[model samples]
Target: MPDEPKRIVEAFSQELHAAYHKAGVRSYEAFAARSTKINRAMHSDTGKHTFVSRSAAYKTLTGKRERLPTWDQVAQFVRVFRAEAADRGIAPDSVGTMEQWKAKYEAASARFWAAKKAAASRIPAMAAAVPAAFSDGPQTWWRAYADVVPAWSERYLNHEPLSHRITSYEPVYVPGLLQTPEYAAAVIRLGHGDEPEERIARRVELRMLRQRHLERVGERPCMWAIINEGALRDGPVGGETMRAQIRHLRSLGRHVQVQVIPAGHPAHDATDGPITLLRFPSSQFQDLVFLEHADSALYPSSEEDLAHYLHAVQKLGLAALMPDPSRTLLRRLEAEI
Candidate 1:
C-alpha cells in the first residue's frame, strides 16, 4: 500500500494528478490551454473569461502551491478533462465525474481554509501571550514562564516533547527528568538562593511537569542518563531526602536507563559541564546538542560543534557502568545513605 500523504495539500494534489492522468492528459501546458478554451466558452455570455496559466495549472496539479485553486478554476479543469476523455471514448466516471471531483475539492478546500485560519490566528495569540523578553524571536513561547523554568532553557524545552530519544551526561547533579520532587526542590533552592520560597516551589513544579513527557502512555522518549558517581555521593540534598532520591532512581529502572561514571575515572570528554543530545523521530529536524551553563545555555548549530558533542556523549556512555551494574551501584548507595 502507498504511504499516506503527509499534508492535506499533498493528498488533494494526488487526487487531481490521478484524475488528470486518467483523462490521458500528458502536458501541463496542454491542459492549461484546454482549460482556458473551455472556461472562455462557459463564460462567453458574460464577456468575462477566466484563463488558466501554465504556472497556476502546474502548481495545482503538482501540489507545489500553498493554497488550493479557486472553485471556478477547479471546475474548468474538470470540464476540460471530461471533454478530452470523451473524445477518446473514455467514460466520465473513469476520469472522475464532476460530482465526485466536486466532493473531493470541497472536502480538501474546507480543511485547507480551516488550517490556514488556525495558522493565521495562532501567531497573534502566541505573540500576545509571550512576554516581552521572548517576543523578539520565533519559537520563544517558553519564555513567558521564564520565572518558573530557566530562561536560558527555552530552546531545550521547545524540543524536549518532540524528541524520540534523549541522552544526557551530568557530572554534578541528577538529570532533571530522573530527579525526584524533593531532589528537584533542593537543587532549585540552592541554585536560586535569592528567590522567594514560593518562586522556588513553582520552579520545582515546572521540573515535575517536564518529567511527564517520559511518563506518557505511548511514544514516550527513551531516556539514557549517565551521572558521575560523585554527583550521587556529593549531592546538595542529603539524609532522608538524598536516600529517597536514590530510591527514586532505582524505581525508575523500568522507564529510564541509568548509568553512573565511577569516581576517580580518568579525565574524559563531557567533563566541562552537562550535555543533552536530543534526537527527533523525523529526519526533517536535525539532532540538537544542549549545553547548559550557570547563567546561560548553548545550542551548537555548526556541524563541527554538533559532531564534537555527539562523540563526547558516546564516549561517556562507553566509560559509564552498564545498566545492570549501574542499578547495583545505586542499590549500594541507597544502603549507605
Candidate 2:
C-alpha cells in the first residue's frame, strides 16, 4: 500500500512539474499557480498537497479530468521549459523529488518562488542592490554576448565616434543596414517564398529598423563595403533597383566612406566570402568580427579570433581602392549609369 501511494505520488509530481513546464511558467509562483489550477481540474484545490493528493490533480498538464496525455506527450510541451528557466535565473534542480516532500512538508516550489518575489518587492529600498550592469568581478572568461553588445555600444558609440570602423565584404547583395527599400523588398520576397503577408511585413520592418543605426545623422557606424566589380554588374534586384543602390552607395561617401574593389582585377580573396569587422574605443578588447551566412550570423569578440579576421581585412583592403579613390570610382559609376 505504501509503494502504491509512492507510485501515485511520483505520477502526481511528474504531472505537477509537467504542467509547470508546459505552461511556459519558469518562476516558482507561475509554476505553483499553474499546478494548482490543473490540480483543481481533477479535484478541489488541495492547496500545497493538491499535486500529491491521489484524488486531485489531473494526469494532463491542463488539469482537465480527461485528455490526460501520457508522459511522452508531456515531453514536447515542456521542451522550452529548461532553457527558459535558465534564462530567468531559475534552476531545474531546485524542484526536488516527492519522497523528500513526504519526509518534510516543504511549501510548493512554485508558491515559494512567488512568495520570495512578493517579499522582495515589499522592501523597495533594498531592491537597488544590484547595479545596472552586474559583473562577477573585473574579469571573467564567460560573459554573455547579449550583454557585450549593449555595453560595448554604450561605451564606444561616442568616444571613438571617428575611429569605429566597419569594413565589409558582401558577396550576395548590399548589407542589410545599407540596403534600399526596393532592394530589401525584392530580397525578402525571394527568400520568404510562401511566407504569410504578416511574416513578409515583419522581415521588411526589421530591415527598416536596422537602417536607423546608420540614419542617426551625426554619430553612426562608418560602414565601408567592398563589392567585386561583378557585384556592380550582377544586379539580382534588377537595373532600376541596382541604379538606385549603386547611386546610393556613391552618395553615402558624402557622409560615410564607400569603396569599390575594381571589377577589372583578375581575382581576389575577399570576394570569397563576406566578413564584417568592427573596432571599439576600448583597447582592452580587439575589434569584433561578424560573419553572416544566409540566415545565421555570429559576432566573434575574442582577441585572438578577432586578430585573425583583422589580418584578413588588412590583406583584403590592400587589394581594394583607398577611401578617396573608392569614392571617386563610385562617382564615376554614378555618371556612367
Candidate 3:
C-alpha cells in the first residue's frame, strides 16, 4: 500500500468515531473499546480464525478482525439456538481456548445428530427455528446503519447499502477512493510533501482497505460519478496509466453507474464544483447528502437539501446513458488505444 492517506478510511473511521458517541462513549478509549467488538466477531463467528491475537491486529486488518462475537452477542445467539437443541440437552461450550472449543462443539453436534437418527421411536419434534428477518428494502437497511453504523460494521462482515448514495463530480482529478495505487501515491507525494515514509505507507494501506466496500459483500450500492470530459482526455496519471484508469471506470459502469458530462454541455447544479450525494432507498424517506470542498466535507440531510440532491441525480440519470450505452462508449474509448 502507498503511504498516502486514503479517503475511504477517513470516511468510515469518522462514521465509526461518531457511532461511539451515541453509545454514550465520548472519550477515545470508550470509542475504541466499543469499536473493537467488530474486529472480535470477524475472527470467531465468520470463521477467519487464523488471526491469533488483537494487540496489533488493528494495524494488520484495518482494525477488521478475524475475531468472534462478543459474549453478549453470543449469549443472545445461543438462546435462539438452544430451543432447537432442546430435550436432547444440547449444550454449547461457553469457555474455550478456541481451537479445543470448536472441536468439542462439532463432535458433540455430530453425535447428537447420529443419536437422533437412530431413535426413530423418540417423540417427533420440530427441528428448525424461524430464521432472522434481514429486510431487503432501503429504509430498513439505512435505519439499521444510521442507528449504529459502526456497530453494524462489527456484526456485518459483508457489504452494506448505506443510508445514502455518494455521487462525486470530478473536474480536477480522480477521486482518491477510486484511484490506482501508483496514481494515488503520486498525488499524495504531491500533496503531502513532508509526510514521513511510515505515515505514507499506513495511509496507502488504509485507502486500499476502504476500497473493499465497492465489491466486498455484494451489497454496496451503485455509484454515479460524472467526470468532466477534460478529466477523461488529460491523462492526469500520464497517457498509459490514465488510460488504464479510464478503462477501469468504463468497466465499473458495467456493474454500477458512471457517466461523463461533456464540458461544453450546459452547466448543471454540480457545475459549481465537485459534490457527493448519498441517497437511501428506504421504503420511507431517509435520504442524505454529502458535499465536499477543498478543506471540508459536510453531510446535509435536511429534507430541503435531500430533495435538491435527489433532483440532481434524476437529472444526471437523464443526461447519462443507460448501462448498455455507457459500456459501448467505454469500449469505443478503449479501442482508440
Candidate 4:
C-alpha cells in the first residue's frame, strides 16, 4: 500500500521505456541530445528550446524520479521518439501516437497524485499522535522561530521549505529572502519599534537563516523576485546599509532571478499589495498564494483567487525590466548611494 505511487510511476516509466526501444533510440544520452536538437530546430525563430538533461532522461527512463514528468517533458519525449521512428522508416503511430501517450501519461499522473494524497492524508493524524517536541521533522525548523515571528506568517514559513519554486512581488521594502542582514535589521526595528532588542535581533537572525535555503547545494528552490523601483529608492534603510543590500541582491547568482519595475510604469494589477506564490514539485499539493498585509496575512486557495494572483504576477513580470537590465539598475542604485 505504501508503494502504490511508486508502482504507478514505474508503470508509466516502463511504457516510456518500451516506446523508446520501439522508436529505435540507442541510448538515454542519444535521446536527450536528439530531443534538444529537435526542440531547437522547431523553435529556432523564438530561440526557445527545452534541453533534456542526461540526468533527467536517466531518472525518467529508470523510474527513479518521484514525480510524474511535466506535460512539456512528455510532449518532448513523444516528439523525439516520433522523429526517430520517422527517420527509420517506421510509422510513428507504431511507436505511440501523441494522443495515446498523452492519455497514458495523464492517467498515470492522476493515479500517482491520488496515491500521494492518500499517503499525505495520514500525516496530520500521525503528527497529532506524536508529541511535537520529540518529533524532528521539517516543521521543526519553523517551530524554532515561531515565538518570534508573527502568527500570520506561520503558513508561509511552513510551506517555504517544501516549495520547489518561489515567486514574490514587492512594492515597498526589498523582499525578505533577498534582504541583507543590515537591511533586515533596520526593517525589523522599524516594524517592531516597541519590541525588545533581543527579539528584534532574533527576528533578524530568522530572516537570515531563511536565506540559507538559497545556498543549499542541489535542492535549493528557484527564487524569482519582482521589485518595484520605489522599493529600492524609498526605504527606511539607507546609506551604506542600503548600498550593501543592493549589492547583495545583485550578487545572488543563478538560483535567484531579480526583476525591477521602473517607476511611472503603467499602473498594474498588483497594486493592491505584495504577493508570493509557492509551487511544490509534486502535483499532489496545490500551489499556494500568500497575500500579506501590515498586521495580517491571507492564504487564498480558491480557484478564482489562485487565477487572479497568478495573472497579476504574470503581468507584473511583463512590466518589470528584463533580468540583465534589472541588474544594471541595481548597479546604478548601488553606485548612487
> Which has the greatest TM-score?
4
Q: Kindly state the number of residue pairs that clash in model 1.
A: 0
Highest-scoring model, lDDT: 4
Q: Candidate 1 has which clashing residue pairs, if any?
A: none
Order the candidates by TM-score, highest first: 4, 1, 2, 3
**Tens-digit lDDT track of model 1 for 1-337:** 0122227777887888888888888687788678767755754454333445565567778876544555656777888789878877889778787888889888876776556445434323322433443232544535545766655577678768777889999976899998898889888876687988888888887788788889888887899899988678646565578789888989884658999987646422225468999877866556777877555555654566668888888888889999999989999988875
How many clashes would you count in candidate 4? 0
Scored by CA lDDT, what does every candidate get? 0.72, 0.49, 0.43, 0.76
Q: What is the TM-score of each predicted model, taking all chains together?
A: 0.57, 0.48, 0.46, 0.58
- The Cα error of candidate 4 at residue 298, in Å, is 0.4
What CA RMSD would you report for each candidate? 25.2, 21.5, 22.7, 18.2
Separately for all candidates shown, the number of backbone clashes (residues 3 or more apart, or on different chains) is 0, 1, 20, 0
lDDT tens digits, residue span 1-337, model 4: 2599889978898888888899999887789779868865865554334434565677787887655666557788889999999989989998888899889977887787677667655534322432442222444576777778677576678667767899999866799989988899887776587989888888999998888877888888899999887677645565678889998998888889999987657532235368899887775567778877555555656566678888988899999999999999999988875
Lowest lDDT block of 10, candidate 2: 46-55
Worst 10 residues of 1 by lDDT: 121-130
Model 1 lDDT, full chain set: 0.72
Model 2 residue 98 CA deviation in Å: 58
- Per-residue accuracy of model 2 over 143-202 as CA lDDT, tens digit each: 223232233232222222223566777645677767887778777776576878766666
lDDT of 4: 0.76
